[model samples]
Target: MRLKRKVAMALTSVVAIGALSACGSTPSKTPAASGPKKLQIFSWWTGVASSKALNSLIGVFNKKYPGIKVINEAVAGGAGSNAKAVLASRMEANNPPGTFQVHAGGGTLLSWINAGYMAPLNSLYKQQGWYQDFPKSLLKMLTVKGNIYAVPVDMQRSNVLWYNPAIFKKYNLTPPTTFSQFFADAKVLKAHNITPLAVANHGNWETTLLYSDVLLGTLGPTQYENLLTGKAGTSWTSPGVVQATKTFLKMMQYANTDYSALHWQQADQMVAQGKAAMNVMGDWAQGYFTTALNLKPGTGFGWAATPGSQGTFAMVSDVFGLPAKLSNKTATKDFLKVLGSKAGQDTFNPLKGTFSPRLDANTSLYDAYSRSAMASFKKDQLVLVIGQGAANPGFTQAFENDMVTLLSSKNATAFTTAVESAAQSNPL
Candidate 1:
């Protein structure tokens, strides 16, 4: 389905920037004002709870680094789809924000790294001693070759299934652990006039997220990771992926009719308000539920890995990377140091519903869902979430378009062909 809000705005400046940069001349921004200037930070976490969580962290940052004004310029849309386009326009104009959100994985990072628009944060890592603080596995995703390029803000588990516990109790149901169990429960819920799945077809990124869970559940860990990273040469066209697409199609059948018209949060609200039983969304929904809606973790809401994805953690990191064209590198780097610190992440992640990317973050500050995610992060088979992982951004768009096509037609053969072709055309 096509997105409701304009998701992909045509960034003509990107094309112009490409042409101009090829000619060895790119526009230079007029330098920052003579006095202390505002460190304009760009991001997409503009929702009520996420905004409060970030603003709280900004409060702390201001206390630590006085005389610097921290301006949060967030343009909201799922997975930074809208913000990324806006960011590309600004960066290409050589009017980069001091720092902006980017997926820590190659899916979002490789293009920026390859374009040489990012600064190498290796020296910052060494200077701040962050190598010992963050998880090495996550660091690996954030790294290109031997250099780390971003300061990770938080970690989100993409395959989490958030459901209304009261709705489950009323339906005499427990969280399903497999697809068959899920379908069995879905039939009962549907008969009882409850929408079994909460999904948003108004946006493609959320659809990609929803399908990615079903994809992970069907393909399992090793093959799923391989396929996402382009390590599995033959699996792209395999029956396994087609089966996953089929499962995704079946899951879509039980969704609300207005699912196509609703945004991801509206779809999620169907579950939260007891109009639906479950939602296939990321753990960021946790923040919305707990902080915004004031729902408790174990009592009001519950979380489980998407069916058949137990022992696997499909995740993405929200990170801030420095642009090479910043007019305020000094203030930006100082803020980055705050982002990398334990105090900073601890203050942010609890309310944001993400765990700290750092191994040493205080777990006592985390709730039940976050604590469980942290444990799974350590022991589970971790895979970079394909929607936000290491693939080219164009490839992500192609994948999302194909996913929407597959959902509508339910043609496994065509879906596989389209995805395989997209991957071939846009390799990481």
Candidate 2:
């Protein structure tokens, strides 16, 4: 559930510059001889659960490739905002890491691929027999033209509502399935002096994440996908978008007062401590709840699809790509091989609070919430996550900035107009 950035312009600029350098030379493809090689792996996974999950994956790699030294270059920021910035600098300077984490979709990875910073992994996919392992829908995201660019490890549901079961039980409330029911529950919670929702906007992308769920909830999966994909009949200024914006503003009314001051972990903390009744977030909060807060899945916390978004799965996946000009191509591919393997995915995703993207994953290894998520992922119509990797970087940046404005202005029409304008310029 590592969302993305607010520094859209800087990232855009860096990619443009990197593209120039990328054109000047072709990267080396030869594998270095296997002797104590050091492979630098870069990512934005420094949270307690994510770190543990990464370390476990590294441990697995260490066991198999004992000769290769894995360098963990993790940077901390909500949704990889800080790390993406640093990675952009490194990529622009032509000093790429052996491999790096990226959200798998047009918004994030496509930029790197288009700029020639990433090498196509079609050969690796064929070599590992991964064409049948990962779901076709997921592999579609990793593909540009005819070449697959990265290996996906885990799949996360972005449109989930995590709640304090005790709070719901105390108020005799069921998890809301529709926005009206959600409002009703909010009324009860607020009347009881309990914050109805826990929100965090420290990175400026969380609100946009909330709004993305609202859009899916309001527009339904069909029109929501149409709007995001810029279907001929759809527009960001559609009535559904307006209503969703208004709904987002209304939902904000029940949020904690200090939302701007907290990160996502703290916001999840509010629900864990019973300071808030519900939180609309990706399933990564499950990791925080189970690992950091030491809470159980069913009794300690509860979950449901975000109101009005029952059948749709808003997906965000974490992937690692082979960067061009790597000094240790053999070591990087070894890591990617492990990353895409069934055993490796199983080992990492459970601890990461996500489900493996592999269609044949062992569901028994996952927890209650993760198993439920995996089921939805298999059957539900999947939509890429906004502010994560649904749209291009330019549009994502604009969407986040407009969400910040909408927070203070509470003007749904103006926000829709701004977003629509951005979509026009950025081509969705």
Candidate 3:
């Protein structure tokens, strides 16, 4: 319904413009020459593999659009906090960049739209025919109030469990199926003086991942969606939710002693070095492991769907949101076209260890784990993870705070209460 309406509106505008262009009674005059424009893009990617991937895209973008100079404004801080803070402040000041990084969620972008800091790209979307290439479901994610606002670069599956094959073989353990088996394996690994779960709780995304696994794995799909959507009077106080939280905290006891300060990369190093048995993070970690640790799946390490979780894959795609009121410059349009093009996605997602957001891209470009993820995505429905994507950025922060406190204190009751308060205190 919405697509039809938008297409009709675009056609109407095109016809109207055509009528006006036909009425050329006056002599044509030479157009004024304009200088090249510079567009600054702000992002938080600082890791070796991530930065390399981004630079590769930037190099391609520069070649495709010669008149545009892109100045990278990358800030390093707690996960993505530093970059996010700067973007928020710049947007509020009406000094938004030409393009900025956005997560695959409704929370942060929705807030920006409400604040009048966002510009819809519906007309541009129609002109580029992105709707045909991007899947209907994936496109629906960036659509709000009947308008498209962003271009997704890739989709990250957050419920992946990575394990060291050498360690598993040494322990004579097979991949665990149910949650009971998972805990039992952890115990076995612990007795043998191996850190079973490699976790780095320093970032908000890490905390958010823990929340996602607990909610989706333990609370079940219906209840998880109900709680995230505020459709039911559900609270984290439920036995299922509490039990999940308790299990998460208990699992941390088997983690490395330096887990408190280690980053995800450091934790990944632990698994790569065979110092740890397992690590649960997004598939993007696979890129790092492959690049930095020289890992090969089914040999050095392996990937699996998180155990004890019976639900669809929960994902948040990384996208680029252009400023709404961009300068009517040729360079700007060139950049937008490149982003929406086929070559861009092909060049970006494979090295980043994520699949392209476009539904029509060649899945053959993906790695083994990515191929598995694509297979799951095709068969299993995808649910937008609320903590990462649907809820407001502030609400995400609140959840993160509660998680950090709960994990460090190891108090399930306090954690449940904190989550309840966060849910009740609407950040919208």
By lDDT, the best candidate is 2
Global Cα lDDT for candidate 1? 0.83
lDDT string, candidate 3, 1-428, tens digits? 99999999999999998888866522333232566667777778776656777777788898887777888777776657788889877776556677877786567776776676667778778898988877777777788889888877777887778899888988899776567788899999989988898888666567568567756877766677667766666776878778888777777777786766878888888888988998988777887888777888668788777875544777878777767545443555566677667788788777667787666778889777788887777656566665567677767778888877886688899888887888778643
Q: Rank the candidates by TM-score, best first.
A: 2, 1, 3
Superposed on all Cα atoms, model 1 deviates from the true structure by an RMSD in Å of 9.0
Better of 1 and 3 by TM-score: 1
Model 1, residue 241: C-alpha shift (Å):
0.5
What's model 1's lDDT at 382? 71
Q: Which scores greater on lDDT, model 1 or model 2?
A: 2
Q: Which consecutive 10 residues in model 1 have the weakest lDDT in total? A: 1-10
Assess every candidate by TM-score. 0.87, 0.88, 0.85
Model 3 residue-pair collision total: 2
Per-residue C-alpha lDDT of model 2 across residues 46-65, encoded as one tens digit per residue: 98778999999999999999
TM-score of 1: 0.87
> Roughly what TM-score does model 3 have, to 2 decimal places?
0.85
Tens digit of per-residue lDDT, candidate 1, span 1-428: 24533343335666677887866644655565776667888999898667988998898899998889999999987557789889889878888888988887877677888898999899999988999877787788888889889999888888889888998898899899999999999999999998999888787678888877888888888888778778846556798988888888888888876766888778778888999999988887887787668888888888899999999988788888888867568889989998888889999888777889788878899888889999998778777776777478888888878877777788988988988999889875
Give the poorly placed runs of model 1, Cα more than 4 Å off: 1-28, 77-79
Top of the candidates by TM-score: 2
Q: Which candidate, 1 or 2, would have the higher TM-score against the true structure?
A: 2
Ranking by lDDT: 2, 1, 3
